[model samples]
Target: MPVWGWILIAVIVVIAVVAVIVARLVSSRQRTERLRGRFGPEYERTVGEVGNLDAAEDELAARERKREKLDIVSLPPEARAKYADSWRTVQIEFVDNPSSAVGAADRLVIQVMRERGYPIDDFDQRAADISVDHPKVVENYRRAHSIYLAQEQGDVGTEDQREAFVHYRALFEQLLETDENKDKPKETRA
Candidate 1:
């Protein structure tokens, strides 16, 4: 009730404020780390696109929530074999018509995505959804899509088209392999 009591109260309040601040900072840092690890390069891409960390984190979190609600399923063995055969046909066609081959590759990838239960209404949304489970190959999907866009504009060269096919193949292979691996025995998976 005197000078000493007032001073003690002020010190305690300051300590409590500092503790709260520190706790918030630590919590923020941990959230960032978790998002970074889960999203990988997609995290940086989102941050770059959104121009801020908080918004990017929010977007990534929203994608995670949306992904949780979706019923993404693996392809059946017959479907897998059919898609593989279609891909082989596309590759063979590439020798005669690179442009059409690239176009077919793009469509095939989207078809595979659709068959795997991904919504194919929007390219960006499709990429975001795929990033949730296929973070590593999502970039390849983006790059392939970009090339496809350039091809549509007649801005891509033969070499660029080839690169796009390669990128699409990367994503296609990942998608196919993931479906196959899901069906494999636990002991057979590495």
Candidate 2:
């Protein structure tokens, strides 16, 4: 009711506001760090595309949420073996028919994704969905896809085709790995 009482109330109100602001800042920072750690280069790419930190984080979070609702599963042992053999064949084909080989690699990667319960209808969406689980290799998928498209137009060189195949291999290798078996070391390729 007096001047001193009003001054104390105002100070308390200011302190509460400051505390809320600090809490929010801490929360935002933690979210940024977690997304950066999980997404790696994908995080930077998303931010660059979206042109805002909050929007990029929101998009990434949406991808994670969308992926969580799916029934994505790992390949069975036999299927894994078959895909490995198929990949070997594709790689060998690259030596003589690089363009066809890269296209086959693209198809093989999509098939692996489909077998793993990912939607294969849309390339961009597929890449985004795959990014949730395989963040590190999604960029490789993009680069490979771009090269494949260019190859169809007869604009890509042999060197570019080779690079695309290598990029596809990176993603194919990633697709072959599931959370259960990811910790073990990779086998050497012939």
Candidate 3:
């Protein structure tokens, strides 16, 4: 080929390489934004735990994929009402037996989670899965679980137990709201 033709080919190749790099970068940035939006604080939490952005993103993506495969169904109206009533009873009982009330709150949260189609075989795994849909409340679930563990070891104080109940209530209220919202029409939903 002529010298000009060779130069032209070189310029074309460089342009193609630059374009590919830019496209890849854009795609990577978009993925990061999507994960951040979906996971909220949980995204930062995972990144902190994993110590790397890529690894944390992979872990979060895995959680998303795993959640997609699960049959997470909404609670029926009657079931939701029943669970809400049970939660109210637990709250009222807190006045008489704080420790037992906290324990019952913990169990009720798990029962609601299970009834809503979350797997309860493992606490950590369940929290991870719940984080995919309920990112904001996942931390409350973790805190509540930690308190429950402390209680099991007999190291928890009444104040800590009360705090645990509060954390559990945060997650429980979120779960209940999510279920109730699912039953509402999109135009009527808050």
Candidate 4:
């Protein structure tokens, strides 16, 4: 091959590579900006809700303890031997459903917050109030949970589903935090 031809090919390759790199960079930046714009102040507030994190952590720990204590129930006689331990393991693993884990975690936070005298309300009514579902909290939880599950299962692209998962998780977490904050004791005058 002629040297000029070789040099021309090299330049063409370099231009193609540079174009791809620039395109990828632009796409990534746009995705980040979209997420920021979509989530906005609510995202920041949700991230700042320390109480929700603490509550979720505590509830997860409690679930582990409860799993240890659950009575081992028998399956049907024909399947009992093969499925006995299987059932227990599934229960321990949140019924082998990642979405269930998210729901459980959210419910645990709400329960803890309510026990702490938070004004936690019905999930159904909250959903209706938000004009989404009758059980707003659970509906949001499931949507976010499903995104997480889809991401885990490799059923969708991570970036899009992850953005959705984080967004809904934040919304629900903030709801719990707001419920908890509403129940805070008022300051007494000296």
For residues 1-190, write the lDDT of model 1, one tens digit per residue: 8999999999999999999999999999999999999888889999999999999999999999999999888788788889999999999888888889999999999998898888999999999998888776788789878998999999988888888888888778777765454322121100
Off by over 4 Å in 1: 178-190
In angstroms, what RMSD does candidate 3 have relative to the true structure? 4.5
> Per-residue CA lDDT of candidate 3, range 1-190, in tens?
8999999999999999999999999999999999999999999999999999999999999999999999998788788789989988998998898788888998898898898889999999989988998888788789878988888889988888787888887777777765454322121100
Residue 126, candidate 4: how far off, in angstroms? 11
By TM-score, the best candidate is 2
Among residues 3 or more apart in sequence or in different chains, the pairs in candidate 4 whose N, CA or C atoms overlap within 3 Å are: 123-135, 124-134, 124-135, 127-136
| Residues 1-190 of candidate 4: C-alpha lDDT, one tens digit per residue | 9999999999999999999999998976675454335344323333355346445334333433543453423223444333324323423544355444444444543443344333348653232222211122333444654565565676755354434434454443343333442322222110
Candidate 4: count of backbone clashes, pairs at least 3 residues apart or interchain? 4
In the order shown, the candidates' Cα RMSDs to the true structure are: 4.7, 2.5, 4.5, 20.7
lDDT of 3: 0.85
Error of 4 at 134 (Å): 16
Query: Which ten contiguous residues of candidate 4 have the minimum total lDDT?
Result: 181-190
lDDT of 2 at 53: 93
lDDT of all predictions, in order shown?
A: 0.85, 0.89, 0.85, 0.43
